[model samples]
Target: MKKSVFILLLFVAGSLMAQETRLLRQPTLSGNKVAFTYGADVWVTNLENNITTRLTSTGAVESNPVFSPDGKTIAFTSNRSGTNAVYTVPVEGGTPTRLTWYPAGATVCGWTPDGEQVLFASPRETAPSGFKRLWTVSKNGGPEILLTKQWGNNGSFSPDGKKIAIDRVSRWDVEWRAYRGGQNTPLVILNLADMSEELIPNEKTTDINPVWLGEKVYFLTDRDWTMNIWSYNTATKELKQETKYKGADVKWLAGNKNQLVFEREGFLLTLDIASGKTTQLSISITGDFPWAEVQWTDVSQRASSVSLSATGKRAIMEARGEIFTVPVENGNTRNLTNTSGVADRSPIWSPKGDKVAWFSDAGGKSYSLMIGAQDGLTPPKSISIGE
Candidate 1:
């Protein structure tokens, strides 16, 4: 039978070449472990031996790790003291404990079902910093209580924390895909013993991470256009669709009583609120990506656009999408649109010094111009712009 179909295509290509794919970012789940955030640090995973440890390797970028309802503590978000505050460590890794300094920067958003309070989300007394509120600070820090005066961006804490499901208004673009606009609200649930409010069912589209647990609340929805996993039922008010994921989009959901972790496409998934099954955790991260190693990167403070050389003896720059040229005092430093999968950009430098235009999309559908020829050696003429 064709040698058993070529040995079942080499056992599905050697079981997908012994698996390894990682991008991981903002995951949370607790109860067998799963904190996440790659490259910018913070990692942890066990889910029965998927083993991944590495928690917080400083240099200012840590992000939303959250977990600390007794999961031994995590609470993240750190620009390492240049803002974006709120820190805390020890989920088996030590020394972090900073906790909110406030000069406008807070986001952690989790902790406080009696873990002694951490939760965040800020706008520091909104006046035009663009609405946000729901604070709390005291894991031994000083004062910062504001819990909810409306205006939100992720909240969850109900299992007798006296209610709070929140998500009042947030979405200046949570990734945009299939966004039905108007900031897509619908997910309130408040009620701190009578501030009463129970929305959930907005029809606008991008509902977001709400969480709640026990009689159900969970969230993240694009109402069927990608970001999946949903549920509502606070006693049969029915609204289900627990993950019908059609490939990538349910990101950073987080959960506990029997799993629910999320983040998709860069892998790190979980879900199993009792076998509603959705597993993807095989994790394999092996150290040192040091901003993706290979060193040597000054990028003149992220250039953006420079040009010169109409006899100025070389310049052209353009940073963060590559396209270099440099040499105003000697040589060597070319790069010119190293096309990291085409995005080239507005480079411009040719007025009789031998080409260097830009604008490419490299035909991954439209936008061309391109022109090249200052030593990336011939072969670059393109043209074709629009559509």
Candidate 2:
């Protein structure tokens, strides 16, 4: 079985909408051997030795890290050049090199199995459509190959590298329908050789993130009004709804090979693709809100958005708002941070799945970054940087 990955193309349009379940291909499959950081920074771990190595030491933000086939090098996005561009470096240590200098930005990097080229999605500076563009660059940084005319992001190559799946925003000029329920986006796939694109947009539905296993293209869809697992077969062009969890955020874990792992109501669940069945992955008392963006229509009809953790294992998200964990696998979740309802969000996991980092207002400032271990059995430790 081959593994493929796709990411959500995040952008703001006519109305600040909230609805996304996306993930750039980070090298987490190497067990603790890989993990990407915010601002395009990449780190690799040796699971056998529990050795964590910092691959890049740049002040520029780096993110969305992917490992080479041999696990020797990593490709990621960096702003070292004053713009978000794709850069590659050795897993051990070295100076990073730029792959895309298009001036607009090279956001996401999907590495080929052979580690020769990277497929990515970026906003085009001169694109006529005013949306993002999807392109592929050589590992050594060469000419980019354009794939679509519409705004494309979250592009991933299959384990075999024969197929590429991505999330495409058909247009950037968004016409707000109403920030009540949710907006619509399309989950699309492309055949790398012929450059053919396929749209599997469900009725009045928006889906971001596309991953592949064997023949099924796994993606997150809000078709049932609640985001859950959905699969499409490129050969049959048919769609199947895998899970139905209402009022929850559902997304795919990077390395979950034959099973579909997603979060539902703060509990992580796994679905079997072949049989179209789902099972519980984990559960906790951590009461948290789903991430991406959502059309929050409160009684007053006010509109605001939220950020979700990529791991989907948190209950209370967003510091300054509320902070909670997804109930540890065993035992109750300890209050790591007793912040008084601060707005904290975007909790990401380290390769070892030990430490978690997120942006929050628990510090009383605008938003201070916080890092704590998953063993939230103790008071949540704040790993905010010292000014």
lDDT of 1 by residue, 1-387 (tens): 111100000000111113565678889988888889877889888778778889878777989888888798888988878888888888889888887887888888898788998888988878856688888898878999998788877798887888888887867657879877677878888888778898987688888888888988899887778888888988888998988878578787889887788888788878888889887888877765555544354555767677777887767767766677777766666776565545677788778878888887775777878787876676778878666
- Which candidate achieves the best lDDT against the true structure? 1
Query: What Cα-based lDDT does every candidate model obtain?
Result: 0.79, 0.58
Count of residue pairs whose backbone atoms collide, per candidate: 0, 26
RMSD of each candidate?
20.4, 18.3
In model 1, the Cα lDDT at residue 309 comes to 77
TM-score of 2: 0.55
lDDT of 2 by residue, 1-387 (tens): 233221211121122213221232233344335454422346554645645466776667777676666667777778888988888887778888888877787776466666787778877764454567678788877789886665676766667887677776643322222212333556667777777778775675657667676777878776676666778877798888777666545633443356544444433344566677766422111112233233332111211233323454433233223334443232343334544336556665666566666677665656667777766555555655553
Best by TM-score: 2
